[model samples]
Target chain A: MASKKNLVPRRDFIKTSALGLSALSIGLPLNSALATSCGSSGKDKLGIALVGLGNYSKGQLAPSLLETEHCYLSAIVTGTKEKEKEWAKKYNIPKGNIYNYENFDDIASNKDIDIVYIVLPNSMHAEFTIRAAKAGKHVICEKPMAVSVAECKAMIKACDDNNVKLSIGYRLQFDPYHKRIINLSKENTLGSINYVNADFAFTIGDPTQWRLKKDLAGGGALMDVGVYCIQACRYSFGQEPIALRAQAFNSGNEKFKEVNETITWQMEFPDGKISNSTTSYAMSVNSLFVSAQKGKAQLMPSYGYGGIKGFIKDEILEFPKFNQQQAQMDAFALNVKNNTDSIVPGEEGLKDMKVIEAIFKSLEQNGARILI
Target chain B: MASKKNLVPRRDFIKTSALGLSALSIGLPLNSALATSCGSSGKDKLGIALVGLGNYSKGQLAPSLLETEHCYLSAIVTGTKEKEKEWAKKYNIPKGNIYNYENFDDIASNKDIDIVYIVLPNSMHAEFTIRAAKAGKHVICEKPMAVSVAECKAMIKACDDNNVKLSIGYRLQFDPYHKRIINLSKENTLGSINYVNADFAFTIGDPTQWRLKKDLAGGGALMDVGVYCIQACRYSFGQEPIALRAQAFNSGNEKFKEVNETITWQMEFPDGKISNSTTSYAMSVNSLFVSAQKGKAQLMPSYGYGGIKGFIKDEILEFPKFNQQQAQMDAFALNVKNNTDSIVPGEEGLKDMKVIEAIFKSLEQNGARILI
Candidate 1:
């Protein structure tokens, strides 16, 4: 999106940044894995308020926020008043920074938090992101962007209209393993890629979870962890798939009554390369393999929340696992501070949304080749 | 296929086995790895001959035969005079045991050789297998069985008619890693499996190789290595897929004009478990993951000629890699001597052939699933 001119002033951004206290990300100088930083004393750090206190917030984002050099988790929006009190005391957030879901819109006048990180369920992404942006804060939404392409567009529009940057939480894009693999493709180290095999599947412990509901999740596995497979293909080739064929199977168990248990698909790029992938909520598998004219690369347990390792043939791509969430959060904050688009901008998530739509459509057609 | 009526006396079978020679297999009081022995004055060893000198024969079978206890590499059948001289000299075979393709039938009268191992191309499997059976020799034909189901049926009929056993060379059936994984499924160690992801893909170094030729290969990667993926799912579930949906993709490279570069499919069994697989000639990948209700199992570089490792959830299934071909050959010889069916009999091969046919049909129908 084109930059909105003479809108949110540079000084206002800094004023909000000065209010930042602590965060889940730690950017200090240049880390071997990525360019990270500790914000200069002249510039106040940006403060981010997480919209949901779900597992992701409690486990990853909240902890990483302390490490972020440019941003801190200064506030939170949660329906649980008990959680709000506990978090405010634990994280040392002032009472003024605490807000419940009903009072979230009132954040517009509060200058303490400059960014709203939406980590809610899939269906709630659009409403929260739009509200966050309209509240004069840059927005960072977790992936699948939204339940549909329309919601994604609306979020993008809301952020653009408010002159606030819109970023998506695609943490893997900042990960060293994937970044190196993408670099290999960019440099044609393996020649033209001929094939890609990516599968991400795991047994869901609770079938009654919100993720299994179509209205809440938009789809099944594809809307959740499957986005990593899509991201892998997209980043590896730096090209969109031109056509695709897909199929969804319900693992006849009663647990899968509400959604697909397994979904498999193959996408063909204009160049004739194929990306074949499978995602299931009823199986455990994580892998990514790329075959090119000159050589091959493979990574088992490819897409993980942590500890992702891989190899180019027999030689491994070695790097210590760093905090991916911290890297992603700090980068978003800097991008927002600079009034520039984040690398995982809303558009990146929007592209995946398009692919997701095509995949479901292909399955609806009973595995017909659906042109993108 | 039904068992053939008695031809060789039971005593004769025991006599041949008691004379067990340096074999491509040793199923005796199991030795450390190989307990190759030459027949003594009291026993008449089963003498086997190889019909091809391709990479598989040269790199795997030939070396393995030297270690076998029940059978020995007693004769040769090759169209190439150069390979005949080299192999005869290298393995110390008698001149009488050497025969060209033209004189292969004449071996029926030689009495020195009891088996014919056909390691030729896809199209040649049936002809050589039938010829060997007609010559009164047990036959081991490499997979895909034959170019067509009719040919597979013909080969089985010829072997049954001649009262000679026929085994398909599916070495993984003998590998301990796969056997254990299959056992886990059989024992319901992980509970009823809900999903499987299997893929085998390799870059074809030579575009003009027989494997890339339509008539020579019968098909592309699916017919070659993809069968491994199929075998994995079949054995893991111990059930034939009741239905399938598949799609074929071209690698877009001119080198793949004669056949598909990649073909991906999903097979559904009666219990609602799904096996999603991919086989590609244009990429390199090998993996198998099975997920059941209780837990998951994974194997990487899973279906290989050798060097396979895997884990059941967090626990690795540890076993030193051994010569799979030797075990396979040894087991086949023991089966023949016992007058019982080889574990991977002609019918086992015929079953996979049916699946292959269904997969192709599904692709031809634009991925409309075909019931098996």
Candidate 2:
């Protein structure tokens, strides 16, 4: 449902500048997204209004907006009155710019807020993104775009119909270490990646949370943290998988009775490149390892808020750590101001959702192989 | 075909000793196998003849034999006459004690050779083991005991019929770091293990070698280095997997036409514990990661000749490196001299073959679930 023209230009972004190529070897600060030019159409920064004011918005996006050059936090939409007052006092927003979820659609009339950043729960992403798109505002929805492929398609259709750009909040795509990984993968520097072993997991507390509720979460660990592993493999290989087989496991824990505690899946690509990934809510693990014909490249603690380290063969990947969320927002703002294509468009998230749907289907069939 | 009574006593060995239990915490030198007693029946050290002068015999087993406290390199069997004379002079073995592969059965009259260690190719293991047993000598066969389950059964029956102890050359059982892992698993130090992710791969050279031939090596990477991953998972969990799903990948490389270039498999245990493992001939990767209820335990570059490191939670496992092959030979020698049950008996290798057979069956069925 996404605009084909918008998705087609993504390959150009992958061909990053010489600065990014040098950053891969020198371990310097990578700001290739800032250097990207689609023939700039605007001179002023864009204003962003964050929806849902959740932990991610409060802990990461709000703080990152303070440092982002192309975007600034101008407004907020929240249901809680305390957060509205606390964030208003903390960020110094004007009274006219404040709105609650009930009056969020009125944001269409406000010209100051150019973008709506959805930082909501798993199942709430599609509703907020579609609403923001219908309101004629560009949207930046967090990862897993939505819980299902149908929701993803609907969100993309709304944005396409409204003629507003939509980007997924895949912060690692703007990271320096991950930029190096992407370059290495695209360049075949390690000789055609043969296998990928990725894992992202952590112990989730609060069994009463929405993430444990199947209706609110749509799925379990695979829908939550497993999306990151899927993203890592796709970006590392620069291709989509052709087939998948997945298994969901339960360890007799009462807390995960309604959701999966652990899930592992294998993906087979067209060129015989295979990937194995696991996402769990019962353990702590964060790593992305790629094996190629010539050598190996890996990142431990790869997908996180900060402190992502990488190693290719004998050399350690050195890059200055920056706020990934800031980079992501800046890139999205540039695309909005210039009217250029998004690096991580709605189609990207939809592709991942398709894989997730296939994984769930495989699990339902007791780990039968499902063609994607 | 293996003596069931001999395999039954292995549970006693798993209980280890107070010294070994303390060694797990203190990271001290582990000599538990040497401390095991069944009653001394002989007083002298055993004499060992290493069959085949390949890389393992030349690089590891022969050198370890010189340092073994309960075994000495009394002779050797080699098809090449040049290696026979070279080993005879280097180890001070008399000419009469040496024999070629064709006349290996003549060792029945030689009192100097008490044990024959089979270090030949994959397909030759059963043949040499059975011949050594017939010659009234104890046998120690290298891993992947034989090409098929039937071969393993026949070899075990031959040893049982001959009434000579038959052990498998599984050296990690004598390692201090692995001993600590075993203790952690059995004691449930990290709570019941929920998942294991293990990989052992290295870029293999020489396309013309027998390892690339199906009839010679039985399988490619799975039979070569992948056996170690299977061993690591089973030992880490102290249980056999009840079912498995396996996938074999080929990257259109002509060198691997007769065998698999890469293979990945997932195993499900009775308690709902799961494991994911990979073995490849086109990449460099060595790791074993375990996720349990309370914490994680791992080892990078876990399986090799030496320099195995381990980590559990916040602690770094530290232990002095001793020759693993020496410990394995010495332990077997002690079992022979004291007339005790071998810890790593032929049955241990047979059990692994059952898993491998299941893996191949699953692969033949295109990764369908195969119950073991």
Candidate 3:
């Protein structure tokens, strides 16, 4: 009975996720599940038009569409003519569907593109998301939704004004391991978790990368990988922090002249629990630890593109792996087909940015505990 | 070749420590290897007197003494009459060797008792250590050597005045896994380590226990378990922190009214690396992570009395295991037999307390970054 209580979620998830991983068609894709309820929607799979041909769009999103049952890569919007040509031939995207940035507004009239997945840089997220919404397409923007909390709010408002759905690409929210962890917490498995330790770090290379530039990146490690740690604690506790204090450190490396090399923070929850976390661009560390009144759950090398392993109490959790990008895209595609918003909507991104903004503020104010 | 460079310390340590673990004599104990120069000093095994029969002493120290070759439990001191009577009978201790706190000084004449291990509460560490030294007995005091750095310094001075050795009971210092980590750092096996994350925590019960009292326990998690986290970061970095900042949180439970429930801190090392760590009494967790330019090394559930597991980059590390308490005691006994001091002297305990004090000070000053 005790084992049953602890092991049920992972077992059930792995059994189903193993099938979903191979293809998003457990029963003829997710969109068809809601297709009969749609009075006028008769599309086979929602057509997704990627708004940026960057590494994320070209590598993860485009490839993920091959396995996604609810969505197919249909069109692409890019500034580089060479990339537009390259992506069109590779994904078999029709010439009529390949739109440049200057002609992105014309996507409103293109019936071939049902959703615009905004996979642009940090500073460009709000503009592209707002523009995509105004172009009569549902929007799924990459993380940080925008550089600032205000931008995130504006993006949310723009999507609402245009009667379109918006989702920040927080793929980890759909991960089996992450879902299992949240289920454990919800089931009171660890007993009102009061302590959370989350960290994500990797050595940054190339000083000339746009991610190191404050204008394009908005912030350093926080805007990039640090957001994952923040999300982990927030999701683990299921409670927003009421107050936080933070410290920032930078390597003497010339590469970090415009940004922090590392940042550590403590978030105080309303119930007196606290989360201690760090995100670094000067080192390599990825893990999450949560402690409650009963027992602890932890994982090292957690929150990766793949190979996230951890344990709940004494049970080693080997959750089935899947294409994270495919899962995320399928989720958004289902929302687009059903005319509903994803669970991880723009508000989720806004909350994370609010905490992040306060963290940077705390660092600027010499490590003061700032109310969020 | 790379494997050889990283795995040599474990190989050499296991080759020698395997012998030390089973019997303190490889032919003779480590002290005997140094003892021939001493005139008329020929002891087969050193006698150790345990002061204060608390949980740690009763549970760990007593059982571990049975496994140790260089040291045996020869006497016990306790203010509690029933405990003294019970322990003396169980350990077959002679009546003359047993004493209460009031009569502890008379042990000076008992040549059978060579080392006095102070396992008392934090407040009593200084008095017992200084008295034991004056009684011509070498001292091994438990961590958080005293309530204040001043007491730690005084304890050291007393030991130096009496020409007796003093060692802080940091059992993990002898742990094979920890030794591997330190060796990796000192050897630059992981490149110049730039980031370290170490946390130790456990939920404290019993509102009336001495650990809950500010006077008896000194401080909360920071002085107790948190010191281990501090030690881990310091040893992993192989550098002392130049500056540190901290935050303290409390469980709403009335038991923690006098002390913190959790404390998180960031220490800035001289080479621009940072160690972020936390200690908690409101929950349970233990882990250590260190990252450098080359790779990283880490252990979760790292500081337990047993089952300390970790990895060195891509390889899972499995070092030879020994009884932690026995290793610590035998090493101290060897120091006694050889007329030498253990490596973790009173000054080491003092250094930890100084950092701990600064952490608390930083918390008091609203998370100010203090120069260490």
Candidate 4:
């Protein structure tokens, strides 16, 4: 089992700066700084650009930017000209900010764009984020952070070398109810957590989505919804798993060879607490549960795009409506402006990816217990 | 993996008139008469003889009998004469029906005692149930049906030879909400079952309880609450597991020497569905979830000794409370009168015991996947 002492240390400079700045930032009242910064006359709003305008970018992210006060869509980079024109027209984005895939590097000359969010297919995340960082822009990348641990490491190194902040979009870290559950566990309100039962699944009828292509989506439901359960386990227990045992099922259809239809796994933490988790593309969705000595807390439809609810002792916890994507983007913007570290930084994503790799390996070996 | 074809055919004579007639003579209903006599009193109420005047017997079962119209506590068998006298007086049981453990067999001479309910510790279940059967009385045994597969087989054989009906107290089978989940899964209301997630755990603080003793309790949480989750998995999917993998933690507590304080396991069934289950004495209680292609149904607090509630999609299904122990006793009574096979027969308990054995074996081998 990996000890807490073995964990990678947080970046010393960012940690120090974060502590010092948080005290100063807390004193600034909400919306007061906003008027001084982003008035009609001043270049106050952070100029954000989206690279690789895929389904996630179109459906979730770009729409959220319309409501964000501190950030605005300043540019676009996509391979498809048709989509670029469509998005530009819909959002009233100027033609000067539009660029195709071939001329994306020239975005360095565009002074309007300050942050570049990479929403590409999985395999291209590292390439675009590194290039954007070198072009003097902070980066926000969608998760599974990168396809492998090595890619994650490389992406982190590239961002560090360019002196730009890097954050992975683990939006649940900002979700109010999820945060409440984590805080409750951290305070030992439920005593020491002993077990966690979690699952994420959905029947995906489409066989031609990017999720079915290993070269694009990295893996199957594990990369998509399963990672959320994994992240939830880590954040909820406030620890990393040291060992994992897993079993995976394939659809056996030729079309599904690149991705699994279902996978079930267990992760054991050092305190002898276990997290039992499963993800499937052919089953119904389920809640995420953390069972502790005192009681249990569950979030039904935990990682869904909307209306996440939390329950404790069979009673639902009430919290404000939180747009997780917006919260994540706001955090990224604040980190970029104030030179702060992200709560779910690149390193955290790397740790989850390592565990994900171990689970897949265990499944390949016929459900052997794999030590993390 | 055992095939469906490999299942032994039900012994015809055991299902024929002689066994049926013998069951009816003990006040259980015959299968042929079940439909017409759904709520009718075809036979006189069976006079039950309690073999152990312990906490579970006094607390759960005896109180349930007061409200039960079809069964009556006519006798008592206790090692302690004080308890025997106190219980007989409290329930208006006749002093002639009272017998010490040494004289329990003499109850056969008294025709009033039609059934003997054995609610003893692990090691004593087999002996008493077998003795009760030999005394020509129907037997109702509490769960973990026997300490081992051999012991379970012995109980079944003894009951078969004595021509006495034997029923295991798997009360959930009679529970309306649990039955609804099973029936809905069978009817494909949730579409084809793809996965099942279940857990039963509680913080067991008392180190001196009989449940902590391996000799008396058989195993820890797995033998206690886990049996219920296992039964739920089987009936919810209506199939036996073909293979299993398990891992357990001893938790560094000497009090749980012969059993595990926490255990996590997975079972693969014939239809490619996997049941991921966990049981622990260190964690709090949990629900059981069955995820299918269309939707999921969960029983929150699935195995609690209270009213079971079912959740499907967004709706909760609440059923009328029937005392599980009393309902089980009444089912045994009806089976005796009608001369029918038990819904939770000795063999069904034996099957679960076999799976439990396999889980322990797998845990011993460091979480190796084992075929059932």
In the order shown, the candidates' DockQ scores are 0.49, 0.34, 0.53, 0.45
The predictions' CA RMSDs to the true structure, in order, are: 8.0, 10.6, 10.8, 7.6
Task: Give lDDT tens digits, candidate 4, residues A15-66.
Answer: 3344344434656433333322221123456778888888888998898888
Q: Which lDDT tens digits does candidate 4 get at residues B151-190?
A: 9999998887666778888888877778787796677787
The docking quality of candidate 3, as DockQ, is 0.53
Runs with alpha carbons beyond 4 Å of true place in candidate 4: A1-42, B1-43
Which candidate leads the pack in lDDT?
2
| TM-score winner | 3
What RMSD value applies to candidate 2?
10.6
Is 1 or 3 the stronger prediction by DockQ? 3
What does the lDDT read for residue A171 in candidate 3? 93
The candidates, ranked best first by lDDT, are 2, 3, 1, 4
Q: What local lDDT score does residue B249 receive in model 1, on the 0 to 100 scale?
A: 83
Query: Per-residue lDDT of A100-217 in model 1, one digit per residue for the tens?
Result: 8899997765656778999999999999999987776888999889988889999999877666788899998898888878887789888787778788888788778889888888
Backbone steric clashes in candidate 3, count: 0
Scored by Cα lDDT, where does model 1 land?
0.80
Order of quality (DockQ):
3, 1, 4, 2
Each prediction's whole-model lDDT (CA): 0.80, 0.82, 0.82, 0.77
Docking class of 2: acceptable
Supply the DockQ value of model 1.
Answer: 0.49
Looking at model 2, the pairs that clash are none
